[model samples]
Target chain A: MSTPARLQPGDTIGILGGGQLGRMLAQSAAKMGLKTHIYCPDPGSPAFDVSNTFTVAPYEDADALDRFAAAVDVVTYEFENVPGPTASRLHAKVPVRPGVRALEISQDRLFEKQYLTKASVDIAGFAEINSQEDLDQALQKFNGKGVLKTRRFGYDGKGQLMIRSSADGNGAYAALGSVPAVLEQLIAFECEVSVIVARSLDGTCVSYDIARNHHENHILKTSTVPAGVTAETLNTARRMAEQIVTGLEYVGVMGVEMFLLQEDGEERLLVNEIAPRVHNSGHWTQDACLTSQFDQHIRAVAGWPLGSAQRHSDAVMENLIGFEADEWHAALSDPNACLHLYGKSETREGRKMGHVNHIKAKALTEGET
Target chain B: MSTPARLQPGDTIGILGGGQLGRMLAQSAAKMGLKTHIYCPDPGSPAFDVSNTFTVAPYEDADALDRFAAAVDVVTYEFENVPGPTASRLHAKVPVRPGVRALEISQDRLFEKQYLTKASVDIAGFAEINSQEDLDQALQKFNGKGVLKTRRFGYDGKGQLMIRSSADGNGAYAALGSVPAVLEQLIAFECEVSVIVARSLDGTCVSYDIARNHHENHILKTSTVPAGVTAETLNTARRMAEQIVTGLEYVGVMGVEMFLLQEDGEERLLVNEIAPRVHNSGHWTQDACLTSQFDQHIRAVAGWPLGSAQRHSDAVMENLIGFEADEWHAALSDPNACLHLYGKSETREGRKMGHVNHIKAKALTEGET
Candidate 1:
């Protein structure tokens, strides 16, 4: 099919998931005078509160997907776990950005590792496990220690088991519903970092400053910019991101999470995973950068030129998990805090409710750099 | 009624009028995890695109107004011209912010001038003209040169006629549809500037830095921060804004436009007019300041504590008039430009389509101060 023309100001964007990411993308789309029609199975999706229109139906409903595709000029999803058949059906009617390949690779951990290795990017050693014996054999290669994860539908530490020794791998395969999985060697990294990068339809790519992330209970808690890594390390992270996007022929923002390993007093970067959509680590851009990851993603998917990823201030973004958002009153009292609370009706434990960005003068931070 | 409790996340803010101002307000409300229900007469209202829910009914529809009031925790308006009866009706049901007093005073030029004078704020010389003779007499006091404006419902140079001389006064009263009008002495001032201030429910007030304004055909064209006024003039402007909000017992943001007169080597500020809602001149705050005018207005109306009104960078905001938004491509190519399109369907002449904020390093601009 011929390349779709660029979206005009009043055109509508069809977002495939109605979560906080889609909600933010809708807000950014509105800033550019564009409309959004969110497609989600849950009627109570947070993004539904801010979209121009929405369809409440399961992703497998061809009838609902067809109507959604007919209503918008282009289609983009907030999450990478979109069913392959669903994406293929939408692609037959309209463009599904980040394309089927990006989605297919990101949905399965083995495919992601293979793709990264093919692109000459460093990644944790991994082997696909189709049976219990496959898991036990892989563990031996990694000194009887590895993270066995389901090849699909895993997020925020779900669908995974950490095997510290051979005995720990006994029922792991059956415990994960006996589905296809991959065992990845667990590396002892100095710290976790992520690079948010965007690529335009024209193949031009840009990356924001590296964000040093901290995780609690296997969930991201905070992302601090100016990751304080050496200049060479920063460049390597950015180059790896650009290389991955280029290899995928991607046209949108992608979050590349990596491990910074300290070996012989030098920094080494390894690709941990790739999210083919806007990621949580980039939320600070909304308050600190010239263009946010959400805005960049929309611009790229709409076939518009990508904006500057330049940050105007240094920021530390902290996610408000569940009941923590109840303290929003205290967050508002800070002069330097920019709070964002996703309009989730219920504050279920372990659910992301919102985030706050604490901004500091750029000059002060740059001096330290 | 005793003070209504502060709005919690997920509470809806009922916004009257569905224009760009309301659109921005809805976006800000969404950022704070609040929902918005837009009330507008126009079915094609731009704000409807990003709102949780909306009612398309005229202000005079009491039943519709009552339904809207029932759905929201509080109500606020985009424009100051909310009819007295409509505001009173909503006020009876839900807490209407900035209060009906701000609306009643700002809706009429004569009442606004009188209210400012009573608040001990200096304003231009003016008089209320009820008849042709009154117009003829009022012009003489200003040397037969003044602006004849309708007492109510005037905006963007409409319902206004300049009486340059005695000949200019002929039929001026009839030209304004024989409505009650106000004739004010026209000041040939050095420049126009405005201060955007927000007053919280607890009566704590805060003001953003003055923005030097430039207008084209009476519509705001650009607003530059670091207005370059003397330190004393800056202090006086902030004090005047604080005094106005306190005297009106206002909640939410107000834009106070003023004239900077170079009477001698020093500068003097005279209050020109006040906007009861977010003003065009404050659009720069969205990109340059820690807390935007729209966000500040929502915080005040919701009874939440105010965020900082601090500017992180210097900025010049220019409005995109009519077809100017068609050139969004060019605006996007500028790395420092933050473009905001209003999602207007048609580009009629003299219509505001969007705006772009060009940011610069704060240190470079602050050094000039």
Candidate 2:
């Protein structure tokens, strides 16, 4: 079937993976008068609470996927780790935005690295590891220190181990459920930053201000915009993001995480990972920018024109993790804070319960100091 | 039963009426991680699409109301015209915010006028008209010129007649179905404006910047912020709004429409009407202010502290009446315009399909010019 020229107000967009991202995506779609049909396995998926229609069934269920595909005009997923076959199945019936290639490449660490290298994007050194021996040899190449990660379904520092020395590499492959993995040379980076970029159906691309991220215990703690990166660095990051999206022929938003390294008093950026969906680091845009990352994604996937990714204010978005959300009252009372809670019932340790974007007056320019 | 000290994140807010206002309110509630159960009789209610659960039954359906009340922690209505009995029934089961008194007072034109007068608020000269003779006498008091309106369930110029002269007063009462009505002397005002005020459960009141409104064919056309009213006039308008809400002991956002009459080289403010819910004039707040009127209303009704009613930018909000929304593509393409469309299937002339808020750089201060 040929794709429609553009989605109208009442067209339904099917979303896979009903989490906070999907919930926010649904809200963004609703803002534009579009309908959302959320498909997920968990009955208590948070996105289900705010969607037009939802189906509680496993992603691998062909019958359920077929019905969902038939019901929606187009499809997108919140998480990049959608099973390849499921996306392919849906794509056969309807347009799955960001396309199947984006999912395939980002789902595997090795493929992502390879794609980045092919696209001429700078990335850390890496090597495929099938067993302990392979991991040990790759670590030697990085001077007996590297980060070992499972090639698929890994997130928030999960399914990975840090090999500080040769002794730490022993049985590392077995520890990660013996899954196929990639070992990357660990760089002592000065700081971490991410760029959220959106590509529309006609190949139009726009990037939001870079967000310097802070992590605590492997989970994002806060992301501050006006990342303080030099103008040259910012330009390079944007160029890299545009290149990556263009190379993939992608549609929708992608979060490109990078390591800002300081070498000889000059800055260098190393492409770390790609998230083919709205990134947590971009949440500040919801309150500080003309268009939010979620809204940008919905617009791009809906075949609408891209909005200006301009920031009207500087902001720091802090995640309310676990019991941290209990302080929602304090967040609400702050005059400068915009509070967002994910409506999840249980808050286990490390689970994101909500977030607060503390807005401030915009500075004169990025890296003015 | 005593209301909870404050509503928790997971608590459900039961909303009455399933129009765009309720849809926006539910979106705001969801942003704060609160669940919403929309209660509207219309099967295709727009709000129903975004809520966790909804009941489709007449307002007077005691069984459905009881079930709805039992499921939600608090109840609020998007429209002031909710049947008094329905609100009181829900109040008996759970806290009905803005309280039953707000509903009873604002439901009738005569009562609203009397309440305004009792609050020492300046309103147009008005008289109750239950018969043609009563209308004739009221018209004579206004020098044969006044607006005759039904005392209940009137909106968007409906159930009202404009008496341009004594001849236009003929069949005025009968035209309104011979219902209880109020005839008010029509002031030839220089301009129209509205103040959106929010009063928390604790009686903390805050007001947004005054919005200068323009009408076309008796329908709202646009509302511009930084309304250019003299600061003294702005102060008085806010004071009048605060007085009205305090008099009613209100616990939600209210839109207080007023006429700005120029008399003797001085600006005189006269109260026009009270909308005891989120008002269309305040839609600009969604994109320009620290806290939107919808968010403010949700916070107030949920027994939370009120947010800052501060605008970071100047905005002009224009309603997309019916076919005007067909230019949504142009609106979306404009970098400064934030478009919002209500998910209505069919559009007829004069029906409100959506709105667009065009934001500009912040001016130095309100009424600075």
Candidate 3:
């Protein structure tokens, strides 16, 4: 295929989904003199505040999607839950970065695992579950301990049921609404980590340093950069992310979450899952790195050259969920803290309201592995 | 007066002047979960693209101003050129930050110099002139070399004429429209620098490190942090900014420009003027400091505590005037560069199209003085 001309600064980039991520993405796009048109069903979407225009419509609205695609030079998204047909239709008109393959694989847990397995990338053993019998068989492989997640439409630990023992198999299967699912073996890991990588249209790829994550209530609470993993393990993780991005022929930023397993003096990383867009774990980059992941994603989607993913500072990023953002007053006075609040209309439980990045110059020693 | 209640995350801030500065201010406000309403006469003002709502009407439009004030919780402006009556009207309806005093002082150069002198701040030898005779008298004090500038409504080297000798006094006066003006003695200065400071509603103050500025064609071309100045110079600059903010009882961010003159191996600073809002020289703070000047402005105007103004990196900020922003492709791939472009549709000569901040960790050695 012939390479399309790179988008000029004045080009309009159409974004699918309207959330904090899209809001930040739109801001980054604006910083490059690029206009954004966000298309989302929610009129109160935070991204609407920062974009040039927006279309309030369901993702499945073909007419709206067609108009949106035709109006912009390129298309990208803030989340992977976009309907396949909607993406396919948009792709038929304008280029969609991260490509449809990445979205298709990321939306379905089974497809993600299958792709990783095919690439020889290490992942937790997973079995497809279409019925109670499949769950029963899958439980035997995990010694009756596993997580049954719906093949599609899962996020923030939702759409997944954990099986602690064989007795919970049938109930767990039913909890998934009897939908097609994948059973992932429960792995006792040391900690969770993620790598945000960006791939330009020319196939050049760059990954940020790994981010060590801590989750509460199935939602990420904090992410610290320089993950405290050994150089070997970090390198392995970066290579894995690059391999995945390459396999998908991606042309935008992707977050690959992993489980870092400590085994004696060695550390092993198991691919947890992939988010085919800027991920929460990468938020630290906004304050710690010269080129933020949002900026990198915009560059990639615009077919511009990829930016350096090197971080300039060590940082601890903590998310403010729901009313926790009420502490914004304290953050305001913090000399080392960089606060970013989504223009959310209300504070809801488990809802990400904002985040704070407390940065320190790199002179501070990295965390001990 | 009882301290006005601190603005909450969902509060709206009404901004006057929908330029690039307002655009950045709006983005910063959104990052704090605050909505912004921009009011400007220019329908194509860049800020409208990022704000939640905007009014394309003259500042003197009482109906539009009243409606805008009613819609927002508080009012702030991006430039000092705001009409004093417009500010008073807004202040009467909603709290206008930095207050009308800041606008009244900063809009007129004579008032600004008078305020600084009253505050015991050092300033260039200046004399108010209403005619050619006044200009000739002012020239006598400066050895016939000085700059004649309109006392109000002047920016970017506009509305000013150079008086190189007493013989040119009449022509200089006519060149300035024979209007009331200020004649400033031309001081052979080493360099120009600026200090950006913020003051909260409760009187808390914070200031960023000095920014050394370079001008071309009387327009700021670049700003470098750390200023390559003595520690004493930096401290004095900070103190001057603090004194000015306190003197004005300002409740928002302000930029104080000064000339650094080296005499007998000692640096003496002469106050040039004040910008009663975010200044172009402070653009480097976005990449070099923990909290950007725009972020601090929003916080102070919203009655929130001033954020930390600590610098974590050394940076050089270069402006992209007009067509120079077409080099965006180079900035896209640069690892150490952070680019910020105003969403301007056209590139006019001398128009501030964007800026690029190249930063390095503080561990890097400072440049030679």
Candidate 4:
């Protein structure tokens, strides 16, 4: 829970990253009569196209940061990669929603694991892989198989490597630029799910229906709503998300990724990662709920009450990767689809250009379809 | 029916007249990955806040019009006030949707009435009022009550006068500077409703669910959806909307105002006026349907098939008029409400600064006591 600072409708909401998520956030902010000023380093960022006000300088540029801080009423970011120093700088000047402490835990895998451990949250077996000897020791303990991820600055299957045996552990450690890393025992999880929760500065929190995601080639392919799970598993997922966010005193929307693991007849949830801002998996909120996660993020950061996170219908969100956005018109003509384009000019493989959401009532005879 | 041309994603859709409607239309265009270039006389027009490009010059500025037309694929205006010469200037270069002919008729009330009449559409009885003698003659045939409106331009109850008596007519005519006017015998009506119809170049027509309007101080106060009309009336509204569009060979979206008259024991509809572009009455489409009227207009003008005009939910949209915008914060706090601001700097009395749309399930049982 954080201070309950109220914001008026015309308040300027400051966004720190300038990707599709931030672009959507700015759009949502404008829709609610709130102005948005985007602060990002990329001079050609897509979000800048829609937002009239922006600072085109690096996050660490003090002059630009100061100007951005002075212009906006509240500050929030689209990604956890926001360096802790930059967050601290802005927090000193403006009400930085989600706060600097949340960034500290999310920016580093080690810090995230440490926070989860102190909260008695479940996680895969792991250890810090610093020295070559440390990798060997962890590899032997985990049946000679484990994943080594950079302690900080890793995303989208980058800055991480899987080592099946100690034979490649030495090579895998170097593949990570020989940086300080966290080693984790790989879990054969049955499925991956995410809970997107919005916690306002007033301590009010609302969680959307969990979504089961399927990734292809290390990129999110599709996400289905009403993720089939027992009531106990659903409640556990919600409680785990609440505990992590409340413990971090986070504000705005936060996504907690988890592994749905099953062993014989036993089933439980395991913490995978945490996003301090809105997650791609929650894109379904734009069509399936009364309020979208991006809109909820703006509302929460603006000191407005958290909106209904309840799902209105079963939904599926498919990411338009690379040139897949070329089929936008066809998707738009589909009676069951709502297409969204990010207005990005450049197209390259694996770049998330846009997404589409389909909301429909879940079939009554649903199994594992 | 004009030839339907395929407009791929990222095509430019040029819009003339940069008022609030154009501002909203530009935003909807950006959401679809389409570029919008707003051409308007006022440099401070609100639509410039969201459009990618803009040209600020008078409508008669041929140099500006040529550049505007050359820079975009198709041209449409936000208001019918677009002069005939300006439409011709653009039409000579770019293919203007809902072309100059429609613009000329819409800008002048006399031409609009004549066209509708030629199409066998029913309308309130009216006579031309030019001189004092003509006013006296019109008053004689008025059956003791009438409304006189300027034939060139009138909106939101402006440029129109109520002729309660011949004595009042002199004062009204004098106030109007005795401009060319049309006199209409006042008719008793049940409710005021508007039909927003979209017609593609190929004559693919689609009309949104009718919007029942409530006026306060002669300005639109609220628009309610589902209009709560009999099936027969609804079908007629759609058919009439289509007929008017097809008659003019109009492309893009046009708003047709119709009077719902319950004369004797039967209900009838009368042609009132037409807006040759995206309209305020259709603002509810943003929240109440899968496809917004503004987006539908861009689609049609871009030569794309019209999206479904399905009403996703019954809605009530209320304008935050004048100083009523002072309650913006309260409106933003409502979970059931969606607020949209025009980004206008001033909020004088009777000026439309913003609007709020509330979409809820239709009150299934009428007269619930």
Candidate 5:
């Protein structure tokens, strides 16, 4: 916790959870002359392929954490699922960017909502249920038509259930095996969007352009830039994101997802969730902006200035899920598509294999209302 | 080589050089789920750090080449200076994308000029210097202003001398130290530019927008987009570059350097040199366009369609020579700048250690052209 606010080049960056985000974060670090040591339980994680050092040990492995912490200058994590013991352990020795508090809140949806409420960030109407009886009470309060999601270890549609009616709500809760859940009335809205913002120790916060996002079965599918949001909405979205970062004293990049609710021409942004690391919606920045979220995360973690976070081109980013990644050759051959295929060997269903970014000159279209 | 054009995932790509370009090319290849085996003489070469396999023997090492060929699907190199025998030996075993013919022509400055001239591409005035008598004759013809350069292995202003007056010309021949050389009349040009065109094995060529480049001490300092040239000059540069690529049946990214000469208030392009691989000027494309030159090179060599070479942003790319790369942290912190550091551990003057690309929106400004 006592680590310096800024990191210099040649410093070792200790990263937890070697997922695709960590893989990319390590690559960006390498490009900035900073070394990365990835600590993940999987020996075969894609991040190891590009890192200078990798430790294959469980999160509870204190010996491994000690060695990893002693070896690196700073620690950051790609995922927010670190156990309390793991987070507390790492924080005791090495300075963890985004800190254990951010991790604790983000790792659990209930805690995250509580933290958001404390920060006065707006969210959709919601209720927490620790048991089926609590679920029944929430259903009674919200009229039972809601989305029920688990309290922890959930992402990309996992641990989520939708209730269409009272009977369906009861059935959904039972289907989930009565796990501790949070139920929220789904916003009957227009679009899903996200803002990738970075906060430095100096409180310098910069947000990227809004991204109009589409999800399939709760998994991110595509993100289009110059999101057809009003100027006021865009500014408000940035403000809301800045408020969240400022409240958390967050370091590195964080993605804040929001739902655009349009009712009687009154548009509102309802906070959906926060991704503690780089989000899929921001992948368009790799080719469409001056600096990518990965590069910005590297810069922030390295104590470098957050880049312009400006979009240089109108862009479309499509995720390579499942067999979609198999079209890599086809994507590479398309002179119009900038393909980013994750080095994963297998293309399992619903798995994020990679993405393709198509950047084009901004087309002059009639302004959206 | 009986390898199919459509390579499946998990294939191995053999790269012939170990420089930063090769390193970047390897990174792209790895991202596409393909393995790379770097063949470079230097053990400390950066590419070796990121590849799955590597051969530390020189290009002329027959055992190494044969083994390298045996270990991979196809072969590609990042530089033109690869000796003919080395390319021939490698080509004998695998399909060499861009082919050995490109290497043969570009490896020698004199041969490159002769090839371009023979192909009907306009080139600067030149004469071969086989003897001191020939140098004097060329000097007399020049009325005494020319650049005498060794015919081979000259880069970054090395192995070159300028002859202005009679006395300087007298000592110039001895200065070359008896190496075969060529004397070229220095043309007064308004600007220097380069066209990076990629040719697929099927003879499909796609050209990137011409970039106006600046050089310091004969080494490239910065390259900016929307080269300060007219639309007419852009077309002329592309056509001249296409002529050379077509003539050689070259595949992969080739950089054709040209002099934009203004004679009597009319602009024209003179072919100066050709680089058979990705050029530094195109580095901005990584962030400014949908597909980067390195990714394009990987696609081209893999027998894939060359990705779109469109420019969506105006970019300024500065090569970090030697200690300049040490500014990685400061550069990374610049919101507008994307720092790219080649993992070269040492710093030496004039050596291109890495580069930073600063990009901005490419909207047309109010102007009268």
Candidate 6:
């Protein structure tokens, strides 16, 4: 890789995809005196409201992609689903943070599991399934209870099927459209936790504390800080995130979601997946920590020194999905609630519309620990 | 005034001005799912980078003004110098928060002083001067030391002159460009402070803690919280701010600057001037308090309930004026510093480029108190 130049305050950052994550990234960029230009296929992208410029075009439009790459000092994306050709074309013109390899590994389950296992990272027992015979054999090996997930374009519990028994193996295979899939043995875990890590261009890495998450209908409902993890477990989680970031040569923030299994007094964590972008579980850091995840990601992408992710207070971030955002007035009425609403016009079912972070102005007590 | 409907999350806010203040205001608005439309004649405005839409036309353009008003749900301004005709034209279409009365009073020094006096607010002795003779008489009454300021269009240290003796009365009068001016008695103040207050449309008001300000060349340099004033003096300042807001029927955030005089072991506060928009001194609230001054102003103009103005930490906000912004890397390297830079392409001498709030996680100690 070539040595990319550091970004200055007046430089423009080109962001791909226009969701809430992109909107927040643009806001952080503006705070550091950098302008943002959003490129997305959606005309009503939420990020456009906070960006300096935008282009409404599909990823396959080579002319639009070339123009965007020429206009910006750096390029980044909100999600890992950017087409490989698009990422390569943009990387040819301007530096792309986090690189294309991270996206390739994250976008497909088969590649993600293989990469984690090679890195000596503990993950759920999984097998690649290319046909009905392969699915049946994997189900038998995994004790007839596994998760069959499509290799690509899966999020928020979509594009996945459950293999209950060998008798239902063919039904599960058919449900997944018989695409290339990964069968992972489902482990009953106590809770889900995530670590958000940032890596600079020169390879310096920093990690935030673990976030205890709760989900409803496969969507993140709330995240709380001081995740009730032992000191040993917390250190292990941070180390795992740092290793993944360094191994990928990432130049931005990435989230590592893990499942903690508590047997007696010993706590063990299994790497569930890796998101090569800002994740929702770190939202509590916006109010509890000194530097928000958005700020850390922007700093890493811009090649600035990473900020300290020190937690100063306890926070509980609750998502206002769909119609729940109608209570925006209630959130506004709370003295300690910091509200953030994406400028989305419609409230579709299961859609994340906004969030409110309720913060207590003190760190957790010893009793909670 | 007719009862105006409350603004919702997806509503548009029309902002009149395209400076750093407007840029910060637009960022806060976007966080609450509100869009902002910036109207300013300057093509390279700092605010245009963050706003949802912008119109680069003079405020006097009635056609553009009408369209902007029609598009936005509510209208507000970043500065008090907006022309009366432009404000009136917008007010006829949509509600303009902080109303025309607040702008009318804060725009002219003579009117501000008169309004405060009528409301029984403590202010320095002053005399309106229309001729050289008037200035001479006011200087004599003020014991030959007074500040002569233009009645309108004055900010920072501009448009003002100091009269040290009677011999230079005509010189000071001519120095003011023979414009309508006001002569204020130069009090032997111990320190300068300000109070940022917000009032909702339904008449609830809240005030942030007092800010101790320091100025260099009449430009604000830093603002430190916990202003070291007696409880009585702090209460007096809040009361004065509330009185001014109620008197003007203000519907947004207003800044009240004051001079503190320590005489005979007693503290006294005299009103210096009022700004009918977000003030520089309140910038510390962004990092030290739960609700920033910008957030409060947005909520007030949107007809939402006022949030708590409580400060949770001790903060010192220093302005990054002109070349001072060159040390941005220093701030970024600090773990506890919150840096905010306005997206200005060029740096000019004495121009405000950005600011940083270095915050301590706790309040002042008993010894400091």
How good is the docking of model 2, by CAPRI class?
acceptable
Query: If ranked by DockQ, best first, what sequence of candidates would result?
Result: 5, 1, 3, 6, 2, 4
Chain B TM, per prediction: 0.97, 0.96, 0.96, 0.94, 0.95, 0.96
What TM-score number comes out for model 2?
Answer: 0.95
Candidate 6 chain B worst ten-residue window by lDDT: B360-369
Per-residue lDDT for A11-35 in model 1, tens only?
9889999999999999999999888
Clashing residue pairs in candidate 2 (N, C-alpha, C atoms within 3 angstroms): none
Candidate 2 lDDT over A1-369, as tens digits, reads: 557747999999999989999999999999999999999999989998889899999989999999999999999999998999999999998999989999999999999999999999999999999988898788889999999999998999998899898888888889888889999999999999999999999999998878899999999999987888787898899999999999999999999999999999999999999999999999999998778899999999999988878777778899999999999999988867999999998889889999999987432211121
Computed on alpha carbons, the lDDT of every model, listed in order, comes to 0.91, 0.91, 0.87, 0.82, 0.82, 0.89
Q: Name the better of 1 and 6 by TM-score.
A: 1
Please, what are the lDDT tens digits per residue for candidate 3 over residues A1-369?
122448887789999999999999999999788999999999999899899999999999989998998889888999998899999998887888878899889888898999999877899999999999999988998898998999999888889988898777867777789899999999999999999999998899999988899999999999987688777888899899999999888899999999999878688999999999999999999987777999999989988887667677788899999999989878877867888999788889989999999887643111110
Best by DockQ: 5
Candidate 5 global lDDT:
0.82
Q: Pick the winner on DockQ between candidates 2 and 5.
A: 5
Cα deviation at A124, candidate 4, in Å, is 3.8
Model 6 spans > 4 angstroms off: A1-3, A164-170, A362-369, B1-3, B168-170, B362-369
Off by over 4 Å in 5: A171-174, A363-369, B363-369
DockQ of 6: 0.37
Against the true structure, candidate 5 reaches a TM-score of: 0.94
TM-score of chain A of 5: 0.95
Q: DockQ score for model 3, please?
A: 0.40
Q: Is candidate 2 or 3 superior in DockQ?
A: 3
